[model samples]
Target: MVGLTYKILPNLTAYGGYSEANRAPTPLELNCSSPTRPCILASTLISDPPLQQVASHTIETGVRGNLAIPAGGTIDWKAGLYRTSSTNDIIQLASLVLGTGYFTNVPETLRQGVEAHASLSIGAFSAYINYAYVDATYQFSGTLSSPFNPYADANGNIFVHPGDHIPGIPRQQLKVGGDYAFTPEFKAGFDVLIVGSQYYVGDDSNQNPQLPMYWVANLHASYQITNNVQIFGLINNLFNNHYATYGTFFDQTTDAQFAGNPVNFVSDPRTITPAQPIAFYGGVKVTF
Candidate 1:
């Protein structure tokens, strides 16, 4: 069967919209002594009980299209509008001191963001890229409320914290690749990927520079020895370029929020050492 189709219309598409906040679960939330009311600091309701940190809002809208090249192949394109708040660092929220016996960092966080992605393909080659921009902060309002002991400050008051940006979101990413067959029996392909900087959870040290830019190359090849048999091999870290997915020094978290917990969040979010060791694999296949 053979067919051809093509069309160019308006670039109009959108999502009704979506929201996400306080998504991260907090220790205070886990420490919920009661479910009906706001968990308390002592026996009284604290301003805000540790909840999934609190991301806030997200909007998604976009359009996409496809084209057929008759005997050729096809091409596709896509774009969109998106907004999202930083997610509360639920994992880090384990530091809020709910009470003398209760200490956790279920601090509320507020983050707003925008994101986009696009890609295209033709013949045997295809590629795509994605990007996200986030604005974040922390919330000190709204106190957690509970009946156990009643959460309250020395002044005996309840309030909620705003929210902050979520850590660990990469701002930009680029990936491109293509495949070509040298012969009907042998084919090989490769791709190059570039990743923008990323931040550790809770580390807003702009001066620290986002995770460094990193680029990596990957390659693969396959050969058919016979009609019923095939062989293949793959090489990773082809460029041998030094890079790190997570920074060099990883921090667990230690700070006042933990009372005495260490604010050891992963620092040096880069490859201070070097990229992973080169890796390669090969195999042969036979069919009956």
Candidate 2:
């Protein structure tokens, strides 16, 4: 790893760096590389070919600056861009068996992104904001087995080409937060988080509709009653927003058959893990 920094101005600076990393495959990844014979994790163990270690090279550049206001406030900001390329990338794919998957190594993959952050402080009030954009894609062409995928071919495999977006990674995200002091002993804060949509875990070929974007808000406050006692409260997901943080493909029909339910049923391959709903919490803190 190497890095460089230059002072472009009295209050500004530019910086860049390059780094290389290697990761060996885990025992689970090494033992479950066979597609024809999908293993059920610890229950089904088998011998498989060894996998190559994953290697990556990353490059990043950015600039940062601080500004002072004559009125009695300060501003700090930074922006940066980064790119990483990896070889022998290990990825998990669904197999012909229901509720099972296998791990395999892809020839190449890439992840590039931009990020920026800014903050302002004035007396008892402070605020900050952050934003990021990510473009994660496959750099090689190949086929993966995904029997549950609706678009899978006759052999229960899907063709993946270069430039296909990787599943389960959002392309954009934003967060804004601020804090205010009403008195020397009381304080309050609020924050908002927004996340962009992305492909499902099994939609590596990018053939299915993406998970919808969503946002959430939260509020918190605290009061000091005495030198040894304090009270705090928080309200999370203030708006009760309905969202899912993760999604994947599954066969509902097969599950019904196993349960001995009626066979006449509609098959919905989509499955999701829903995010938390609005909730409130409060507590008192005491110091000896």
Q: State each model's C-alpha RMSD to the native.
A: 10.4, 2.4
Cα lDDT over the full model 1: 0.52
TM-score of 1: 0.55
Model 2, residue 109: C-alpha shift (Å): 0.7
Report the lDDT tens digits of candidate 1 across residue range 234-271: 88889788776764222224233467755654443232
Worst 10 residues of 2 by lDDT: 37-46
Q: What ranges in model 2 sit over 4 Å off?
A: 36-47, 224-230, 261-264, 284-288
Cα deviation at 271, candidate 2, in Å, is 1.4
Distance (Å) between predicted and true CA of 50, model 1? 8.3
Model 1: residues >4 Å from true position, as ranges? Answer: 1-16, 19-57, 68-73, 86-89, 93-121, 124-165, 200-207, 224-230, 248-274, 284-288
What is the lDDT of every predicted structure here?
Answer: 0.52, 0.92
